[model samples]
Target: MRFRKTGAPISFIIPSGNLGNGVAALWTKKMGLPIQQVHFAHNANHAVVDYLNSGDYEPSDTISTLANAMDVGAPSNVERLKALYPDFSLLKRDVAATSVNDASIQNAIRKSEKHWGQIICPHTATAATVREQIGESTNEWVLVSTAHPAKFETIVEPLIGKPVEVPAPLKAILLNPSQSQNISPNLLELLDALSGPKV
Candidate 1:
């Protein structure tokens, strides 16, 4: 709301596994913004696209894919999305949902690195696909980079044929002082851990 006065274009191209981001986008439109569109770029698991296209909106079993973040089949945010776009007709008009499978996601990631010199994560790759389809336009597009490609080295490195260097910050976090205790599968073990070390 604070940025409303700035008169910024509110077009968002977000990668969604579920409809949480989708709901937020719709909310912007409801709150009154010069929103050109709310484009949802989903991964192989594409319940969001199906819901937006048809009123089916049925949740299904999760299909694992490279874009693990978007691996949700039964999106928990459907109710919230429905609440924002009560009218199915209006929802379709404001939102553009498209699904990209494993093959496409691979291509996107490869193309991104080869052409754009960017090592984008799988989730961001989905958004890039839709952005290309939409083409260059006056509307500003905000591509949400949910995670760093370095995290998914197993998937990305083999495809891109290059090692994704772990970010220094991530390395530091991993190297930070850590503590853990082996315990039985019981609440007592958890409670004991929370109480601090044995003296």
Candidate 2:
């Protein structure tokens, strides 16, 4: 609706690992937006890179990375990806997906702070790096920065060499008394922890 007013073509460059936000953009495309394409930016763990480049969409174990939330090996929205573009060639044409490593992510953060004077999260940094790699384009790309910098202060602050002020709500929550229970990565351990009997 908004774009209809402006008369400009829209493109989305999203930091994707799970493909949820990408799917949302697809939905917008379904709604008849002039969606040029959607770019998926992954960090080190290039789980979906093969699917985009080739026609093979396989599931792999997600490796731990800076953008941990986007660490989905078997992206749940892949079916949507297939449904959107049943043909590999069409998928390749419409969707551009790539990977960025930890080093590149850090570099993006530093460069953005130095040049743009804005600090972005590791996940968002992935999109920034991909944007740079793609070079100049006539279309304006909207990068979907999934998380705020405040949420990833430890990761963002060190990379940018600056202090990120914690927001009021997060600060209050952090100031309050909170307890966390560490549990091994198993259902039994989780069950025991939830049951209040530490084994």
Candidate 3:
């Protein structure tokens, strides 16, 4: 959409958990979009970065981080990426991967509020940190903001020293009652829960 609007090639720094969004960006580029590059931003669980550094794909146990949504170590979309770009060099060319630690994420959150006056969530901070490390580049970099800062107030508020105002839509949704089902870590339990009576 940015390409359609600006008619200029742009690059994206996506916050990825299971490589789903990053792979979709690659497909968008493959379909002849004017995307110059697609960069994957990950938290401590950086399986994609591991694969990019080494020509091997290995899934590890996920590490808990501020970016809880992006704490996926076994990214499901890696096979799709491999299918899209079979050659390792081609894959490397199409995608850039980086990992940000908890300290970096916190620092990025602070820097964002200080510089841009934007209180970004930890997931977005991952991409912001990568963008900061890259310095200024000719390519237009879009850091994908996955979630609102209000969703992570426990983490964001203390860092920014203020309350992140929840948007109207989010506030309305929050007013509605939330429902959840707790099940065991077994397949049958999940199946039973899924097939159980509707609330």
Q: Best candidate per lDDT, number?
A: 3
On the 0 to 100 scale, the lDDT of residue 9 in model 2 is 74
lDDT of 1 by residue, 40-122 (tens): 88887778788877788878788988888889988888888788778888878778888888888889899999998999988
In model 1, the Cα lDDT at residue 98 comes to 86
Count of backbone clashes, every candidate in sequence: 0, 0, 0
**C-alpha displacement of 111 in model 3, angstroms?**
1.0
Best candidate per TM-score, number?
Answer: 3
lDDT of 3 by residue, 1-199 (tens): 7777888898999999998888998998899878888999999998899899998999999899999999998988989999999988988877899999999999999999999898999999999999999997988998999999999999999999999999999999999988899887999989988897866
State how far residue 30 of model 3 sits from its true place (Å). 1.0
Clashes of 1: 0
lDDT of residue 19 for candidate 3: 86
Colliding pairs, model 3: none
Q: Native-vs-model 2 lDDT? A: 0.85
Give the better candidate number (1 or 3) by TM-score.
3
Worst 10 residues of 2 by lDDT: 190-199
- Each candidate's root-mean-square deviation in Å? 3.0, 4.4, 3.1
- Model 2 agreement with the true structure over 1-199: per-residue lDDT tens digits: 6577878878889999889898888878878878988888987767689877667878888888888888778888899888887877877777889899888988999999999998899999999999999898987788888888888889999888889887798889889887898878999888887889545
